[model samples]
Target: MFDWRELLLRNQPQASQTDDTTLKMLEEQLLDLLPPIVSALNAIANLPIEPTWFQSEIAQKFKLMLEGVEQQYLVAWNHVRNAQIQKLEEEYRIWYQAQLRSDKSLYRTYCQWQDLLIQQHAQGWFSWILLGLKEHPFPASELKKGHSFAPETELLLAEFFRCAKPLIQTDTYAVLKNFYSFQAIFTHQSPFLPQLVQGISNSSEKEISEKLEDNEFVEAAKIFWDILIVEN
Candidate 1:
């Protein structure tokens, strides 16, 4: 019953566009893209952190929230964002304890558990990505595509990166670069189950820097996700 056009345009303010205001104007239009994605994200995060935390009921609700996406990429992104949330919470707790001058030994075991749990949660990211790609290979025409000419695609790419970058580690320059989640899936405990799995077995990294112009970073992430979801 939800119209995506209405969702994407609701409460979105149109800014004045000068000749030099091309991408700036575009980012404002893209800003409305967060509402549904953020809503879905908040819905499922009530679960305890564990391997079987993704329940069928929750998955169904999540599926409804993102009707057009493949299940696996959605799952992958969910895990990735959860890991980020856990990491941020852990970091905040550490800062709080430091301020209180708490003894380090009191929270050592809990911190260790947080580290391992975050890793475990993030492990299946690209494996799901691999399986999704194997099931539905991207159209050849969509590979490494740019949003420079396509305003709609630009808005979509910007939203995906905005949702996804939270879980991905960034460097000093604010570029999302590290994807060590590959290390988890390839390890002994977690295995890629596809019989003829075609995926990037090694660590996958990207060079999209957020320090660039808002739209440029979105365009850079366009290439990243194009390669990520479709390039297998």
Candidate 2:
């Protein structure tokens, strides 16, 4: 099993060393990076990947995509070096806010989000690899109040009640919203997904949600997690 904490620690920004200017630069770089990363993930999700392939030659890319974005964002701004990245984020926030007012648009975004997750779920990556990226958090300094990646993250996930107003049709919505909540910015761990995976013989959205709400579902995995965390 992969040690979730290793990825958690690796995902954390070197906020202690990142000055305001550098932080802003890194944020801008991520704003630029995520769209295509999102696209790349979507492309990979549709493929049939064997277990062997994921361990070599960037086949691990899907699992490491977030880390890739963070590292690439921190390394250089060559792509957006001359452009105004802050202004772009502000522009995005404004545009995203407008999307909130249109149920059609927000639902479309929701579908895109759901479709991507479902596709990945088919590949058996949901509980371990994929969900970790969805819920794993960054440092407080990386997600500072309303700046850096904060607005982007919030605008992307912040208020689910509003962003997902038109999205609550089934019990699954309730479960997923909690996972994507904006409050995630303030924390570093989300082993909750795997907790839900315990004792699941076959995985599906419905099955996952059932395990999620059943407290007893994770009873057997308590020792496993304790050992997993310590080993990592």
Candidate 3:
């Protein structure tokens, strides 16, 4: 299990002593360094990695890749040291909002929002990223409000229904709207009722995935609009 937290915490000492301005620069530099390191590790981990089977140059390249990962670790350490908690919270808020609007499926909307809340409590790295991005730091009292990344209320469900009105079939609209109303309860951790889950789940997944995977989102939206024209 690649525990991101463990990797981060273990490297904290190196980052803490680093200057703030240097931190962002270090992160950018290390981001570039991750690919080759990941590639080498992937190659070795995919064994049987017979070092002798490779030419001298190939073996040397693999060794260099491991060294690059080590170097990137140092950069990551600097990022941890200079991490701004306030900035992270802001980033999480932005990401959460973006994800909610992007998620066409009710299931995904529920899952992503729930995950955001859980991650908020755990003080995950992404949470820290959000906190650090906050432009103006507030008092500790405001910090509580700022850090809160819980899902929006049922009013949001009403908004979703309003937005989805034209796209979904009117005959089944009430049934689908009722499903979104139960957002607070539908959790990824538990097994849902087979029939209820299967009914909504199947249609939503196919439609949402197709819409998203299609590069032309506007074109897809137009297709839905054309359905309205045909129905009229």
Candidate 4:
């Protein structure tokens, strides 16, 4: 039982007030979008087995999620981009004044602008963490790596798998393995189940620049569900 607080905070530098503000904003944005995203995922969980029905449900749900992720990332990207330009201007202004061997006010403003850039980068990391948590699965031991943020990522993925594992069926395995195991040599008659799921996950992030639809993540989600079904 690793302490999340200890793991998240140990050796981590304290964020300044400006950084804290930006992080809070990023956190809020993520929290706001989480409900709709989870709802879309839950809809995916309820998909039926019929080919036509499943395809319709998957398409609808995937389109919704993809649009949402793309929108959010684009907004964050613009904010960071703008902040970069402002940061450079402030730096140039500071350097020009530095030769005067005075101007404490200019120095203070420059530091504040630099902090803004730092804050934006932190938010970028937030975006990565949010999507990674949604798609990836990590074992508990992996979360507790000595002196690292690895634990936070692992914890989040572990929690996500716990929630999403209940929807899929263990019987889907044979089909899933065939669909995903493209390396099969003699499988002229490979099953299509894995291919279907892969296709759905692919649609979920088609427009998003970063790949949140990692096959390993999807596989881990399926495995987690299978193990749970077996245990019960």
**TM match of model 4 to true structure:** 0.23
For each candidate, what is the lDDT?
0.37, 0.39, 0.37, 0.36
Sort all candidates by lDDT, best to worst. Answer: 2, 3, 1, 4
What is candidate 1's lDDT per residue for 1-232, written digit by digit as tens? Answer: 2333443243233312223254343334334433444343343332222343343344455445345332322232234344543454355445435523643322232243234433432334323333322323333244334333244334333533443443444331122222213222222223223411233322333235442334354665555544444453
Clashes of each: 0, 0, 21, 1
User: Which lDDT tens digits does candidate 4 get at residues 27-71?
Assistant: 444445344334433333332212233434554654554455445
Over 4 Å off in model 4, which ranges?
Answer: 1-18, 42-46, 49-52, 56-65, 80-232
- Residue pairs with colliding backbones in model 2 are none
- TM-score per model over all chains: 0.26, 0.24, 0.23, 0.23
Q: Which 10-residue window of candidate 4 scores lowest in summed lDDT? A: 178-187
Task: Point out where model 3 deviates above 4 Å.
Answer: 1-9, 48-65, 68-232
Candidate 2 structure quality by residue, lDDT tens digits, 11-99: 35554444567656654545453454455444344332233333233325554634543444334333344255455445545654554
| lDDT for position 172 in model 2 | 42
Candidate 1: regions farther than 4 A off: 1-38, 41-123, 134-136, 148-207, 211-218, 223-232
lDDT of 1: 0.37
